[model samples]
Target chain A: MATEITVGVGLIAIGASLAVGLTAVGTGMAEQAIGAAAVGAMAEKEELFGKGLIMTVIPESLVIFGLVVAILILNLVG
Target chain B: MLRPKQMLKLTIFGPKSYMKQVIEELYDMNAVHIEDYTKKSDDDVFDIGNPLSDNEKHSDTLVKIRSLISNLDIERKNILPRETSFETIEENVTKLHSKVSEVMAKKEYFTRIKEIYTKKEIKKALSSLRLRFDDEFDYTSAVYFIGFVNAEIAKLKEDVEKASKKNMTFDSHYNGVKAIAVFTDHKSKDDVEKVLEDYDFSPIDNPVVKEHFRDLTSAPGQRFVKLDHEVKAVSDKLKRVNDELSELKGENMIFLLSSEKKLTMEVEKGEAPLKFATTKNTFLLRGWVPRNKSKMLKKKVEDVSNSKVKMKFEVPGKHEEVPIEFDHPKMVEPFEAFMELYTLPSYKEIDPTFFMFLTFPIFFGFMLGDVGYGLVTLGLFLFLKMKMPGMKNFLNAFIIASISTIIFGMVFGEYFGFEFFPPAYGEHLVDSLPEHLINALHMHPMESHGALVYPFPHLFSRSHQISDLLSISVLFGIVHILIGLVVGFINIFENHGIVHALEEKGGWIMIMPLIVWLLLEPLGVITGHVYDMLASILPPLPVLGIMFAVGAILTIIGEGVVGVIEVMFLALMSNILSYARLMAVGLASLSLAAVVNDLSGQMIQSMGIIGIIPAAIIMILGHGINIALGILSPFLHSLRLHYVEFFGKFYGGGGKKYKSFGYSPK
Candidate 1:
């Protein structure tokens, strides 16, 4: 029972960190290509700066989603 | 505040001679949208007006002076334009033009010559360098490629000789590939060149001549040096001339702007005839003017043109769409930019700016409710407002939102997630603070030992009541969307009457309250026995069943069968779920704040006295990142919720904003 409790906590720790870390990695990957394209578009027509900004930050919510999942896991684990 | 300002369309007419005066008066009034006359008849009836008689001359002068102003990069402070006579302007511009052109021509000449002479000098030096080989004769069928060679020049020569299938002699000094220039026969040039490709042989810059470099360059070097001096002298002269022109521009900045406006006005007046329908003598000008300004325009025109110009107003046709302009309270005016960003509400549509103003900050604060962050943001906003007066609208929004955040922060009792007055002092802190302050602060979330208490009572604890917060967020979303539905229903009801309103918007309104009642027992819990008694009157499952049936029927009646059964249910549910972002984002930042504090606290413990600096640095960076995300997340999500969730309920926005002919500050 003690070993079970310890394993459960270890798994929870891994899961919580993985949730946030993997999502951040995904956000970074998505934003890299999108931000590149947005900047390229911005270079052509400067007025698209606002639209570019909106697009570039759209992936940011993904990290927040990950944070939410992490928080949920931590709540259960802690 | 709820509706766009009432707009009236007025069409006016006046005589040809007084048209310029009429236009001047109308533009000065700044309340008329000119309708360009479209050709409808055979006799050039809807022709555009000719520009002013001196428009061409004025415009020509304007272009020169405008370019001069831009080139100087001057920021003029004077509001009043200095009145300079046309004759003075003409004379000065002509003189300046000639002088500028002369200097520019000289500068271009010097730049070209300098580039040419610099290249010539490099080539002359290359040619002057002595080579040990034969110099006197030009080979009839062969070429000398006197270029730099690599250390493997001997192998390259063998490759060239083998590939060319001809006699080839290597004569070059070793400075690697840069110094190697091959001399091979014309018969074997292509083959030798092919061999050279692998060896990386590129000919030097001076490709035309192959002679003793010393013999070629000794005499011409002096001439190249002299050209360099001439370039330097001309460059200095050009800079002096450019400075003179720049100085002239600085002094004449006001004059230039005034001339530009004068010229543009003349152009508009001259072109007014095109919009005017003319017979032989009299001209008729027609356009829409605001109703309130119609009488004012009539009086102004009569006063200006001494009763020579006449004006009139008429009600537009039923189908004719009028331009829209919103009237909002000053405090709520900044959020109108958001309305403009999405789309302007059509003439009959309810202006959503006021609604957005009330809800945006609430949603923003709900997501980022932290006292330390709120104060910091508020201070930053105030500072920026002082620095940039023109950006007041943008800064004011954050100021208002930050105030909301501070209010919610006090409610949440979250100062960077540090437990200032832990649940141990929860009741003490609440009782100590003023009632309004206590009520505004939601301090139930702290989790210290002993009975958690609040003097004024908190709605819920964030740390302990995540599920409650999530449900509350959904409730808020429901209330907001329901209000939007009500407004939409009222708007449609006023415009298209009962059945249409029901079909268009009212069905959603009916569904909202029922969904809240049927979906949760917490609504009852939150409201005490009020919902309990209501549920007792109709039994829980039966009430849910009845509400669902009514809502479904109403929705089907309104949006057709498939829409109510599938589309409406799915979209509405997703929209409600979207509000979960509010709770999630809020907790994320708060948790991050706690993590930062934890890490720093750990550092301080681990390293003792020396760790304080690194701990502080980490604290600064971590919190800084969190704060940045704090501002950004709330702002964007609030906008997203507004633009998607609320507006999606019922808003058909695409109206032309009303613009009037007016004198704008330069």
Candidate 2:
């Protein structure tokens, strides 16, 4: 039973990292596309900088979701 | 069969007589025609159209201004014209243009003559003139700079020579590194030297020569420094030209004396009023008129405006159906009923608006579904949908998805960071926790799953069993489909009477009851011979006599063979499969969650004790992502199962959406 608990906790850590890592990677790639678009928009209209910032952050939810999973796993195992 | 078509169309004839009127009318209709003249300008100068005399005069004018401007100072404001008449403005502009050319020519002529007066050539010239000279200054480097200036001049000269075959020569004064020169009809260096000596006899080191050389060395030194002065001179010249041009404006300004009397003629086909007028031998006109009144309007305009003006019939373009007398209250209700039933339009008609509703919730729930996540998402969507001015509708759909997630969370025995009921609550709380201290909803993770029995205890003991999960999913699917069919019947009955409704609605109603009976009979929840009879209808149909009796009675009295066949086919197959959604969505969620747990566990186990923090992090993040993706899967598949497999049995969606033309498009 102790072994199972320990293994579960260990698994939780691994799962958390995988989710976080993949999320970060996904968000990073998404941000690159969004950021490039934002810069192009900004060059034309400097005032849209704020709107572009919000739009660029939209894809970050993927990473946030991954982070949530990490937290849930941590709670379940630990 | 004899209803006149209401689609808009128009026709016209006679190209020359009607082209101008057509263009003007089209413009009023918001049709854009862009004229492109840049291509002509960028092409060869002659191709753009101008005679040799005009071209030469223009170039000469440019040269004259170029020289004067090069020597003078003028501000930017002076060169530009405020307003002027075309003809007088053209004359003044031409004079200024000539001055610019003259300045450019003088500058080029001097630069070339200066280059030719090299140190070696100057020394040779001096010796031949009996004016002995020695190099008291380093003049070699100046030769290169002089060479560059000469190369530019030579290129300009070559261009002119090729164009006009005019030879260029000038007089030059030199003192080693510096030189001053003037251009004239002189043919060569010898001719220029003779003329310079005749003007004033001087030795090689003459003070005048020294001064002249000094000025020459400094002349090109400030190439860009005198730009402001040159610009000022050009401005002054331009002002003088523009002043002359302005005076001509009084003479050239056109005032229409008979503009009001000039009749605007229009040519059109169909019943639209003429949108434009143009001078023509005979007038023709066309424009949009109401469908009902178009014929009358066309005749009236032709007769009243005089038979001299020809008129034709035209119809307005309607990209959509116009409201007609035939579209009554009942025809519109089906679409609303259809939307209410499935929360989406059927696929037979492709409407992109339905896609937004179906995908919005899945996206919302996926982003937020944990009991903790659900409340937050629900709150956020409600706030935006209700409180925000523009996002109300978009957020409203999101709220629906969030509510679904909350419902799913509750069924799954989930709460804020826990489950529906804690297992320890029954034992520990009853024994240890005081009545005042106990919180009814609070529960430990270990306690939650145990305290509550599975919704379908017959099929599942464990909360996560695939069978139980599937049954729940299909149960939802069945109900969703049944609702869609009920709505479909409402539409059918309204449109074609109960006879039509029976053929469609009877099948779904029959299938639902039989399936409900079978599921309930096995659980022993209902004790009746009806279950036995309904269950047998699936395989043996021992009650074929009963079914035939009902069929014969219903058909003879009312809904015929169609109703009987629908009941048989739909009851026999579709009803049972409609419940497949229960299995599909339930399994989809459980398997995904399990995979997330398993994969995250493996990752942690492989890493040693040093991997503890990283493992925990991985598990949390992985499951979080899985939760989001998990949320979308169930909602979408659930909706899909209802919309397609179940509701599709009765619903055919191709109802036209209402569009108001006079309102602003959203």
Per residue, candidate 2 scores C-alpha lDDT tens digits across A1-78 of: 233656767777899899878988998999899999999999999866645665565555456446545544654653
TM-scores for all candidates: the values are 0.73, 0.38
The CAPRI quality class of candidate 1 comes to incorrect
* Error of model 1, residue B324, in angstroms: 1.8
Q: Which ten residues in a row have the lowest lDDT in candidate 1 chain B?
A: B522-531
Q: Please tell me which predicted candidate would have the highest lDDT against the true structure.
A: 1
The residue-by-residue lDDT of candidate 1 on B1-666, one tens digit each, is 887766666655556677677777776787877666677767774455565577678778867866655655556443443466777877887677676665554445344434434455434334433544456434445665654333366787778778665443544332211245565667777877777766434344342343334445465333222344534654675577577767766676676666666655555655656666765556676666666767777778789888876666777655566677778889999888777666788878788989899999999999998888999899989999998877788789889999999888877767876645534466566657677755565543333444443322334446556755766676677778877778878878877889888866766665555556643553221223333444454445666666556766777777786656654555565565567678888888889998999899899999999999989998999999999999988888888888777888778788778877766553
Q: For candidate 2, lDDT tens digit of each residue in B137-216?
A: 22322211011122233444444334332233222333322232222222343443443333222223333234334454
- Per-residue lDDT value at B298 in model 2: 41
Cα error, candidate 1, residue B79 (Å): 2.5
Error of 2 at B618 (Å): 2.5
lDDT of each: 0.68, 0.41
